[model samples]
Target: MLDQQAVDAEEERLRELATALPDLQRQQYFQQLKRELRDPDTYAALNWCFLAGLHHFYLGQWQRGLFNLLVFMAGLALLFSPWPWWGLLFIVLISVAELWALFRSQIIIQHWNNQIMRRLLQEYSSAE
Candidate 1:
């Protein structure tokens, strides 16, 4: 249940720590832990093998999860639509899009985590 506020607060705290800390050893350890906390491989597996949006939810991306869920539900509805041919086409398109997402899941999540880290570092530097 990581709400936006909590995530923001934690980022702020990490920024503060980054500013106050001068020990490279400690900073490296923190970075390692952060990477472990958001392992891209694990998230990719979750996204592809289980729920399509589970990785997004795990990363505190509720909106992304919601969007994926809605799209998936719409695809499911199309499965029972009156126009079976059109519905099948729609489902196929959605499934293709999903496959694209699955292939890019690791890169996407890694990029997101990197952005967060970079932003925190920038904030820390500015605070100092």
Candidate 2:
């Protein structure tokens, strides 16, 4: 079995890899997207798919992330309930809200990762 320290170190490394992006390539993609979409705010937020706990998986928090994803999926499944249509409608409404939260969380995580990558890259390039 791996020791706690070793596990911690591995987790840290994985988190770094998860958040690290190719600066030049990412910048080029961002620029292209910006040019195509005149509204900056529209693309500023993180993608809903990423926010749905995919970032957590990237950071090595698989269990927590997976749990959240399952919850979201459950909520979606609830929309198909056979009870009165009202129950289904209510579940659908709740699912929408959950989706919104997932989207917001993803955007926050992406911004955070971008900031960290930017700093790391700046330091690495400057040192060379």
Task: Work out the TM-score per prediction.
Answer: 0.60, 0.32
lDDT of 1 by residue, 19-90 (tens): 565576447646754664577687778767755466678788899887776666676777788866665665
- Please give the CA lDDT of all the candidate structures: 0.64, 0.49
Off by over 4 Å in 1: 1-21, 24-37
Model 2 TM-score, all chains together = 0.32
lDDT of 1 at 68: 70
lDDT over C-alpha atoms for residue 72 of model 2: 55
- What C-alpha RMSD separates each model from the true structure? 8.7, 11.4
Model 2 segments more than 4 A misplaced: 1-47, 83-128
- The collision pairs in model 1 are none
TM-score: model 1 vs. ground truth:
0.60
The candidate that wins on TM-score is 1
- lDDT digits (tens) for residues 7-57 of candidate 2: 445446644643454676445544543343222133223224443455455
Angstrom error at residue 110, model 2: 9.4
lDDT of 2 at 34: 39
